[model samples]
Target: MGQPGDQFADLRTDYERHLRSERRLSDHTVRAYSGDVESLLAHLESSGISDLSEAGLPELRSWLARQQTAGSARASVQRRAAAVRVFWSWAYETGRVPRDVASGLKSPKKQRRLPATVDQGAAAAMLDGALARAEESGGPVGCRDVAILETLYATGIRVSELCGLDLTDLDADRQVLRVFGKGSKERSVPIGGPAYRAVRRWLDEGRGLLAGPRSGTAIFLGERGGRIDPRVVRRIVHRALGLTEGAPDLGPHGLRHAMATHLLEGGADLRSVQEMLGHSSLATTQIYTHVTTDRLKRAFEQAHPRA
Candidate 1:
């Protein structure tokens, strides 16, 4: 009965709950979608629209145009458009709107941006530095850092997945990790000997030094002995990469990209790599194949005898 802006508070709360409970989206994802909807509703209120039911394709287009004029990235605009479409679809189905105003809306095509990765030499140097620190310091933090870097490059898991790991998730006898990925999907990723040994060292000596009453079942612990935060993991990765000369500054995701590209270059099959990386789509895994191909082309151009 009130203005559309006034209705937003309760509706947004319900929508956020739906995303978290019904859709099983991660906290980060729920925040992004909710933020996009907030932007749209704010735009509608500024346009003097008192009721959401009155919004149409024109209003949607104008909002998108304003974002473009403001120089929003194409990918951000696309995601924002998708968020609006999903919100309106839900609204229509719930009998709040006569029809989905965003049903006809479309986003611009996503730009093709290749994932960034460190070269093999840089990755090796980083790992070596991590190991050197572990041995030189003989401290809990040093050993944990080595384990973290090894696990990240060896398994290609997300930072959240890494932080979420528990002691039971490590199948040490089998040399595999039980990884919980996006959307709560579970996958078992095999690890090499180095990663296994690094983890073992952390478990045997490092974790106990840092473990407090709050450590619980968490495999990785912060200085206070609580579950490690993803931000700390990112900082560790960035600092480790800094040890390698000429390596691009990258976070956990750069390790993921490097792992995938290195696997493809090593002749691993696409499906196997896909399963290891826990990607839902083959198309996503195929990007690493392109990365491998680009590297091969560069090598051929540099080394071939033909002028």
Candidate 2:
């Protein structure tokens, strides 16, 4: 068995590879885990913990306490703790440590922050403004922009998922879109009538105008006719929101949040919303229920006879 000090890098490398190959984590997630483990190793070095076998729960807790004292957010602390646990588990399995010291280590409980979701009227106005700007430009790019916003809002898909979509992913006749989500999980999400119309318009008019000989099977294309980048989608969403009055300046996720919030507000079931949003866990979907409750409370205060 290799000594703990000598195996830190090897363990980290293997852990990262495991995350990529076995867990199928996205690049962003792999980077986050890598950063967390690196931060822990740096802390261990400063703390003089030279051997993996020498580490224990007290050392792990102490590190977490220091993080708390340094004002780390609960979410970050939780993630760091999770990373440490994964690292120790890998180390133990690979004989770098006699046992997993990080076993049963509790992470700081995170208070979930409710995401900001725009109201239906504001959402409509924002989409309208985006479409108007696209029309005013009177170009293929503008039409494509309008289509992108419509698809995002309509399907409640992540920007990355939307950008990864191909032309065959859309079943226009069935009003469904095949979305590849986190961990490359695929789900069929529905698109509404308005979004369908917008997408059809883009395909017929805008795409043909922008597409060149090199254009591939991507449903959304850039001016040069290759696949559209996620960064461009973010920029388009940011600019579109800026043109709206009093609308919250959120990225594409805001539109997704808006869609879930509005759906729940309009009597959609929680499980159905969860599936539509492609959330693997119902817990993640429950946050929107709280948003719905807050809205209900406000409505009751304004209109109930008891008040």
Candidate 3:
């Protein structure tokens, strides 16, 4: 058997390739999986298990225990646990180990915390303020920022999906956007009129100002004319929300939550909401229903005085 360090490095390369080429995971997910697996391998080496075949359920448990001791959040621990499970399962399937020991592994149940959201009025104020700011600045970058926020809220698409958009993805005539989501799954989502107008303004007055050879087919471009990074989008969203009082300090995902909650509260069916949000499962979309449920509970408590 090769030395533990040599074997682990080789295995991780193959594993990451499998994740990208076969599993078709996003770049973010692949990086996360790679980090988690690296941590586990380091734990095995420190525990004196020289081979993956010798690292069994007990070793896995020990690694998780160490994570807890190191003050890892529950969600972080859960994700890491899942990461190892996938890794060990692959190792066993590919004959790198004698058994799929991680198949029996488990992590803590996901906490049922509700995602944060702003009410419709706050959402309007945010977009309105963005528009006013864009107009006042009288520049293309400001115009682009307004369009980015509107598209996120109007369609509830993920930040990555938004960043991936190209000029061809916009269907102004159809009022839809051809979105490529996780695993490159494509879905068509309606574009609200305001969002469409904002995007058109950006394309007409903003995008051309920033586009360059590095921009490629990307609809949005950075200050340097490269594709806009998701981090920059988050920053723009954060700064906008941070300045708007009575609104939670949130980024793109918060706008997504607001979009879903507003749809549910406006009597949109769960299935339609699920499709709009590009959720793979209706169960995932059902969380927004809980937001409406909580509102009902508060109203009932305030109005009912028979007791």
Candidate 4:
């Protein structure tokens, strides 16, 4: 080609195309993977390895070791490693490389930190604050805010799933939401009366005010009347929590954790919770069980008099 770097650039473009067209990854994911692979290619060049076919696990490990030396978080290193492994997998499968050195690569073990969540009382207070603000403002925006908080706390869907919702996604009669989660996997999440009423009020009294000509059937719209952005949803959660006194600082995902933990404590089975939250594996849902168990242990330790 024109230069040694040109081949790397071309391969990077092709890899991005493969991630988007064949892997069915989201644009955000595709971009992240592309950036990681680009970094790997740069490392390869620095190592005087002009050809990717000549690259081996040693080169890959050195690239990751440099990230560690640079103080990259373990999670970041893990994700980068995964990106490289997939990249080489693709390279070998496509005949760009005779062998996949990345096949032998391993990511750092992920640290399983307990997800932070508000207590039930804090969640109630947060929702109450949202509703009070709606009442005081007497505006469509306030109504929308109330609906957003209520829906997130009640259904425990991801911010993206909440933003992706259309009016048709709501089963108003049955009080359930048709949520498309990660990988476009659809799951039906039941809504309690508080969440249902909040959504109904927004649909009736709020969304019309924000509807622009470009606004489609999306259930939630931004101030510009376009489908709501996930960032906006996060801001809504953050701002609501900020107003709620004594509540922990958390985003939309915190609400998901709170919902799961509260359900587990309320006697909901793991399988039911798993299905509601759209977790593909029961093990992923089991973390909440640990949360509940720890709480129970604390209570026992506090109340029991015997050693």
Local distance difference test, each candidate: 0.91, 0.87, 0.90, 0.91
Residue ranges of candidate 2 with Cα displaced over 4 Å: 1-7, 212-215
1 against 3, candidate with superior TM-score? 1
Best by lDDT: 1
For candidate 2, list the clashing residue pairs, or say none.
none
Cα-based TM-score, every candidate: 0.96, 0.92, 0.94, 0.96
lDDT digits (tens) for residues 83-160 of candidate 1: 999999988988888998798999899986789999999999999988998799878999999999999999999999
lDDT of 3 by residue, 1-307 (tens): 1224876888999999999999999988999999998888888998887788888888899888888898988899999999999998899889999999998888887787889988888888888898899989999999999999999999999999999999899998998999998888899999889999999999998999998889999998899999999999999999888778789999899999999998888889999988888889888888888899998788888899951
**By lDDT, is 1 or 4 better?**
1
Query: What lDDT is obtained when candidate 4 is compared to the true structure?
Result: 0.91
Q: Over all chains combined, what TM-score does candidate 4 have?
A: 0.96
Checking candidate 4 for backbone clashes, the offending pairs are none
Backbone collisions counted per model: 0, 0, 0, 0
lDDT of 2: 0.87
- Give the CA lDDT, 0 to 100, for residue 52 in model 1: 81
Candidate 1 residue spans exceeding 4 A from truth = 1-4
Residues 1-307, candidate 4: write the lDDT tens digits.
0123776878988898999888788888998888888888888888899899999999999999988898999999999999999999999999999998998998789887788999999999999988988899998888998999999988999988899999999998899999998778889999899999999999999999999987899999899999888998899999999998989999999999999999999999999999999999998999999899989999899999971
lDDT of 4 at 133: 85
